[model samples]
Target: MRSRSRTYSLTFSIYSLILFNSLALHASEYLISYRYVVKDSALYNESLSISQAMKKCSGSPQIALELQTDGNKNLKKIISQNSEKFTEYIHKLGMHVEYKDTTNKAMNKSTTIMTLQTTCFTVDFNDNFAKIAPLK
Candidate 1:
């Protein structure tokens, strides 16, 4: 009886390990959107198109995309790593994304916004989104 119990425990442990590995492997599908403003730019006087800015993503599928606090700045590539979550948010907003960043020299993305939803969302990068897997 003891030997049987040990075997059962070992099997359960193996399945748990597999589940954990799967979750980690796909974590990037989700990301927290980071928003901010850049008070240091030449375009201090002009109205920028939000859609046009995102459409200019530099060849990446795009992930976490948001207008900088001001129109002249943009946040790209940062969210591409977690495009899934980003896309989901935009979709939930009743919109589609992947805009252009036609401005010369882009804004630096250092911070990210917190996760928008407690459940799942798209990241808009690789056209995928998933829920934040619970940490072990």
Candidate 2:
């Protein structure tokens, strides 16, 4: 009876390991939108000393990252890598990203607006590095 019990425990442990491994292998998808502003040189005026600027996408995707778990180093690295990948994907898809530039002579300021839309593939730092695909 003791031997049989030991066998059962071992089997359960093996299955648990398999389950954990499977979960680790799974990936999550997310849709990300990022926006930023930049100075539009073309619209800038030297006489007025205007600083031209443009806005990119509105913001980033909603992904909560805890400081305690998602350290700055890992977060920065991942974000930089994702940006490169997203740019490449956009170019490959022939996506046109338009930035609107404007200048206000009276205000002595110029603005350029830009938007970034893409699906980011990510890996969970806490989930055994499971792959996360971009959201549709």
Candidate 3:
């Protein structure tokens, strides 16, 4: 009886460990968000032009636009094929890359482990605060 109980306890412990590990693995998907402010209207326009060009070149209008990176196999495939061009576009954006924590609870929870590479970009402007409005 003692040996049978010990074996059962060991099996349960192993199963629990496996379940926990699986959960941790699934939690590894990260949603990285990029935010930048273009202070100059000319620069912002230029950035928009470059962004449109990037979309044309990549044949993916979603490129440089707001994208949901997690589980986006199509976007992943596009970026993998045009990594150099994508890097160039980001570089041409001419904004300093700054890492900041997301205040969103869902985003924070999803990114707890961060094993997968996911990214998002958002260009936000406050008309009342900014001297120039974004070009339509």
Ranking by TM-score: 2, 3, 1
**Which has the greatest lDDT?**
2
TM-score of each: 0.26, 0.36, 0.28
lDDT (tens digit, per residue) of candidate 1 on 81-119: 545664565555443222223334575423222222222
Write model 2 residue lDDT over 1-136, tens digit each, in one string: 9999999999999999988765554323233445545564553321101111122223333433322223433443445545555445534533434555444665555455444554343335553222333322
- For every model in order, what is the number of clashing pairs? 31, 24, 0
| Candidate 1: residue 47 lDDT (0-100) | 20
Q: What overall lDDT goes with each candidate model? A: 0.37, 0.43, 0.36
CA displacement after TM-score superposition, residue 112 of candidate 1 (Å): 27
Tens digits of per-residue lDDT for model 3, 27-114: 3222232233333212121212112111111111233323223344343344445556654555554445433345475644111211
Q: How many angstroms is residue 4 displaced in model 3 relative to the true structure, after the best TM-score fit?
A: 3.3
